[model samples]
Target: MTLNRRIFMIQSLLGTVSLTVGDQAHTEIPVLFEDDSQARNLGYKEDSRKVDTAKFPKYSAGQKCAECQWFKALPEGSTGTCGVFSGKRVNRNGWCKSFVHKE
Candidate 1:
């Protein structure tokens, strides 16, 4: 192949590779409580660290985000507005003792 043709072929190959890789780019999900101002205002602390539910009285069974009345599963995943809070996306894994089943 001629020098110019070889360079053009290489560039075309590189562009195809880039396009293929770009299609697989993953979007990162934002942290729920990057800023705990809302949690703090509600008199609750944002704790991402997992705790032993069996040993913890606060982490009772049937008090999960999925079971909560406010839970609304979006196309992305489970996110919802808390009954306690007017408007906020409660974590799908979040839990509280006051969780109530949606009718």
Candidate 2:
């Protein structure tokens, strides 16, 4: 076999293994800190009930990240990714101004 062919086959195998292993060992998303700039801007609170009612009058007692359209619900944790904050995670019970009800 050519040297280039061997290299390609090895790379493909490594890529496949990486993906498989990654899927089996999914890491929990870290909880978003309320102090985070974006969180602050969105008035995100770890507990939706704690959201500043004065600042965000639209927020209701029942609003939650787990039910928000922007939230990417994690399979096994109380934290998940939000479309508004790409790299950071938000608590499933958290609330933010940008929340939209999931259809």
Candidate 3:
């Protein structure tokens, strides 16, 4: 079988990145802080109860990162990965304007 040129180039690039990053790629993802600029921009609150409804009119009483479609909780923590904040963990109880309820 002949290798497609595009596929070969993609594979080579991925291999290079994997080798270059090595173990560093597996290092723990940092937790997103409430004061983080990205979080502030999105109005993220570590505790859903602490959200200022008057400031964020879109937020509802029950919304949280754990309930958002973009969140993926780790097996053993109160934090999870969020699509809104790539490479960082958000508190499961966190609230952000970007929240989209999981179906």
Per-prediction backbone clash count: 0, 0, 0
* Candidate 1 local lDDT, 1-103, one digit each (tens): 5569889999999999998776443222333462466554433323323434554556654456666686664445655446664445566666544556667
List pairs with backbone clashes in candidate 3.
Answer: none
How much is the lDDT of residue 11 in candidate 3?
96
Q: Could you tell me the lDDT of residue 95 within candidate 1?
A: 57
Q: Please rank every candidate by TM-score, starting with the best.
A: 2, 3, 1
lDDT of 1: 0.55
- Indicate which candidate wins on TM-score: 2
TM-score of 1: 0.43
Worst 10 residues of 2 by lDDT: 22-31
lDDT of 3 by residue, 49-84 (tens): 999999999999989999999999885668888999
In model 2, the runs with Cα more than 4 Å from the true position are 1-16, 24-30
Q: Sort the candidates on lDDT, descending order.
A: 3, 2, 1
Q: Kindly report the root-mean-square deviation of model 3 from the true structure over all alpha carbons.
A: 6.1
- The list of candidate 1 runs beyond 4 A from truth reads 1-58
